[model samples]
Target: MKEIRFENVCKSYGKTEVVKNLNLTIKEGERLILLGPSGCGKSTTLRMIAGLEDITSGSLYMGDKRVNELPSGKRNVGMVFQNYALYPHMNVIQNITYGLKVQKFPKDEINLRTDAALGMLQLKGYENRLPKDLSGGQRQRVALARAVVKQSDYFLLDEPLSNLDAQLRVSARKELVKIHELYKQTFVYVTHDQVEAMTVGDRIALMYQGHLQMVDTPENVYNRPANIFTAKFIGSPPMNVIDMAFDNSNDSAYLAGQEIPLQEEWRNYIRQTGVKELAFGIRPEHITLSKTQLKNGLKGFVKYVENHGSSYGVYIDLEGNEIIAMSESNKWPPKEAIYVEPRLDKMHVFDKQTTNSIGYPTSIR
Candidate 1:
């Protein structure tokens, strides 16, 4: 069952729309990541689900019940804020049980839930420590425990690991998945971090400029992006998008005035689309930098190279456009003339006017 759903839901602050007409669904026990850059309304969308933000128009349903007018307390969702939202004066034990105390849950039940949460989150011996005294990871655990104690069917977290250092964030992510496994809930995580979204989310709902860009699994979001925004957003160096035009023949396309051959399936697809002006996209890792010209290679000069520790990024100047190609070795120096050949099967062609990818080869269907 779809545990949460939005139908044309929109939220605006007076004249400015914060969330545009949104149509999305969160499944019963799936972890859905609401991913986008800051001010893209991912947090606002999460707030709307928790009933903290009012839906200016349309319907929001939680398990067949319209929750547009529901109060925050009545919605019964457990949320962890970006700041962790732990009470400064309260100790870990008190902070985790405070919600249940307010709700008047029986003393014995509250103790049982608190014990379970504390043990699961590994805070058994540190219950006496106040939020101010705990480490960042410990504090985050306390905040998570507070939510876990509620045992709500819906779990929400907004940039929960953004405050931690790189290594701590990695460990926290694992804990979150572990928590979800112990008690399966409809998890909605909001983050600007693509790494977090790709790692923890069962599916990612990518948004941009208050619009739902695409909703797909991490693999599809990375490999088969719906539009230019998603193609550029999900990757580290991002996809290399170069201006291309269909040549007189369907078997080839022109990139930087060089005719590059297309695979038979891509040729057929582009020919079927009949769009002359095109934006060709390929991931950096899919591109190979060669010292000598190869078949279907575009000639370019090496602008510079960047060491990524594990891999090297070779920036090549294709006419006036700069494209990055990932290499295992950095043999080419500055100003070296080289060729870049994109994997034919990995190429993505988008309609220049609409900025939408022409669907993959029919064989991919």
Candidate 2:
């Protein structure tokens, strides 16, 4: 296993810069996920690490050795793409051992590697089957098996599970996690899927507009987002952000026309920071909804309801701003107006102008 570090790394094509001043250190044997929307330069950053794209400036290191000029083959990194990328003409065994054979590995060593990969990825029974004969999931496993047999120091995956069905993708994610645990190789995965990033990554590197937004553990990225973008991007239904005003003289905050209750610590922070206008945010799961009005709760009319398996998302419109709250009961479109109350400890406060988090000085929990 080798640690990968980027020091002021930048990538561009002519005049357009896709990656800008990236400085990140990926620990050895850690699964780091590059997560963001399209055109955010995640795949481009991965390509640069794999030596598929040249770094426009700065340096990239693989455990102390600078690899800015290294070829992809010499980098000893295994890669799997979204499109399977398996040879349709070759059988499973042949496909898995192709790289080893090209590297002129000994017959016994090749057999040993292939057999281990096949067993690890549960593809032993389909060794003789061609790519055309296998299912989509099986084909994906074969692609993974091929990469595993290489036994490279770094494993780079670019949306490898994107093509699989929902159920298959879940299983594949588990298998990938298990493979990483067993192999202990440095993994750099790229995807726009938030679920995948939250599930499979040890640390998530969120990027936007060629800039690194935040790099932290999945839990941290979700619970203690650095800014409004991080908070909004990481959640499922996304966080509900509402513009609010704070009165320093009374040490009170109000949303729309209703007063918002804040914990003592939060009130103190806001008073010390002297912030007047703020963007208050809370996750849907953290907000509780009630048919009857609750004390110190914001009331809104039910706009719609979205069923999510066991839970229902109740969308409520308070004034002109919309907020969603998760409900366990099957209350589809409440006849009466609903009341929404965000947990005082769970509320996030961001600067209205800068859109940066100022809720808690440190991460909550």
Candidate 3:
């Protein structure tokens, strides 16, 4: 296992910069995930670490050695691409042992490594099967087996489960976690799927338009977001952000002309920042919905309802803005207005101008 570090890294295409002044350290034997939408420079960042792309400016270190000028073959990194880049003519054993053979490893050592990979990946019975004859999940396993046999210091996977079906992807993800547990190698995975990132990564690095938004554990990124973009991007239905007006004179806050409960910490934050307007955010799961009005609640009409097998997603219209809430009970009165209230302790306050979250209360944090 090895630790990877990027110091003041920058990547550009002529005058167009795709990665800007990145500085991060991936700890030894850590599973770090790079997550973001397409064209967000995640794949580019991975390639740079693999020595496939040269850094425009800055230094990259693998453990104690500086590898900015090292060739990919000398970097001791194993890569698995999204398309399972397997040779169609080569069977499972041939594909897995090809790299060792090219490096001229001994016959006994090659056999030992191949056997271990096949048994660990659960591809023991399909050793002679060609890529065309195997299932999508099976092919993915072959790809992983190939990378495992190399026994490199670092393992890089770029959207390795994008091609599998939903059910198959779950199994594949579990297998991946198991493989990592057994090998304990440094892992760096890239994907745009939030579910995969939350489940597999020890720490998540969220990127947007060549900038690093936040790097932390999944729970912190979800509950206490650093900015408005992180709050909106990490959740499934996303956090509902409502524009609100703050009255600094009396230490009160209102949303759409309705007064909402304000905690002491929140009032202090508003007074300290001296901002008259801010964005109020709360996750759908954190909001409670009821047919009757509740204390410190906003009234709204039920606009639509979506049944999601386990829970019902209720969309309510408050004046002109829309708010979503989740409910375990699916039964609802037709065309009836419902009242929704956000948990005061779970609310998020953000600066209107910068779209960055203001500090939360100590109890909430």
Candidate 4:
């Protein structure tokens, strides 16, 4: 299987640019998810690889050869589109065998590959049903079968599970992974849904506003975000950010004019950096709420509570800033006074001016 590389790739239509200076490499035999919100240029990037979109500048490589002008049919890539893209008029077996037949494969060879794909995608008994007659999940499987029969070097899926219901999506994701293990093809998956990105990808390539933001394993992207946008985008409740000021004389940080109890190491790092204005971030799960005022705690009032099945999200108002803390249950009513405490090790600090992470300031003693 071949890997795909993008070197300073940019895509534009007339004057409006979509993908800007993208530099990323999808490693061989690994699943890489192109993840971001709508209009982030994720689908455009995928299309570029599929040769469906032109790269206005820079180079795209498949393995060692530049494939910037390769035709879609000659790229040795099997793609599943967001709509499943199955032929409405063709039955399951016909759709799966069409490509092989078009390529002039032997009749026996076509039947063998088509039958294998049908069994693999659990469409054994539905071979005679047309795409219009199949349900969303079944049509999706037919699309998968079509791609699978090709057995190309690169397998690309653009939000293939987006149209399925929740339960079907879960099973489809598993099937995709299983298929990857069997084929060992380089997989490029595109999705705006973070859950699919987290669960399916070997590494996630996050994009924003046509720029590639960060690329890393799902765990690093969640816990060690590169910037404010990444930190805020990965979580369900998101990370809470508060503007803070540092007092040089006292070697302390203040939030809403209340002195924060900064640990000695953090204070040392802060002093070393000399960034007077900082943005402090803590995830909802790392914040604790106390009814009684604890020493060095930040005072706040309960603004609201939301139940997320397993836990309660307690939103608190600290002066004008609103933040959330996850609790096992919702005991505090709205307007109740509360104190918020954050785990020091789990805290995130960012440069206020650039909105980039300072990287959990710490060093060997």
Number of the predicted model whose lDDT against the real structure is largest: 1
Instruction: Write model 2 residue lDDT over 56-103, tens digit each, in one string.
Output: 999999988999999999998999998989998999999999999999
Q: Residue by residue across 1-365, what tens digits does model 1's lDDT show?
A: 53999999998999999899999989999999999998999999999999988899999999889999999999889999999989999999999999999999999999999998888888989989999999998999999999999999899999999999999999899999999998899999999999999999999999988999999999999999998899999999999998997865436678888988777777877888788778999999999779998887889999999999999999999999899999999798999999999987888888888898888987753
lDDT by residue for model 4 (152-228), tens: 99999999999999999999999999999999999999999999999999999999999998999999999998889
Scanning candidate 3 in windows of ten residues, the lowest lDDT window is 330-339
Indicate whether candidate 2 or candidate 4 has the larger lDDT: 4
TM-score of candidate 2 to 2 decimals: 0.96
Candidate 1 displacement at residue 96 in angstroms: 0.4
What C-alpha lDDT values do all the predictions have? 0.92, 0.91, 0.90, 0.91
Model 3 C-alpha lDDT per residue in residues 224-302, reported as the tens digit of each score: 8999999999998899998988887788788867888798877887789776569999999999988888998998888
Q: Estimate each model's TM-score.
A: 0.98, 0.96, 0.96, 0.97
Off by over 4 Å in 1: 248-251
- The segments of candidate 4 whose C-alpha lies over 4 angstroms from its true place after superposition are 362-365
Clashing pairs in 1: none
Residue 360 Cα positional deviation in candidate 4, in Å, after optimal superposition: 2.8
Candidate 4, after superposition: displacement of residue 175 in Å?
0.8
* Native-to-model Cα distance after best TM-score fit, residue 162 in candidate 4, in Å: 0.8
Q: What is the RMSD, in Å, between candidate 3 and the native fold over all Cα? A: 1.4
Stretches off by above 4 angstroms in model 2 are 332-335, 359-365
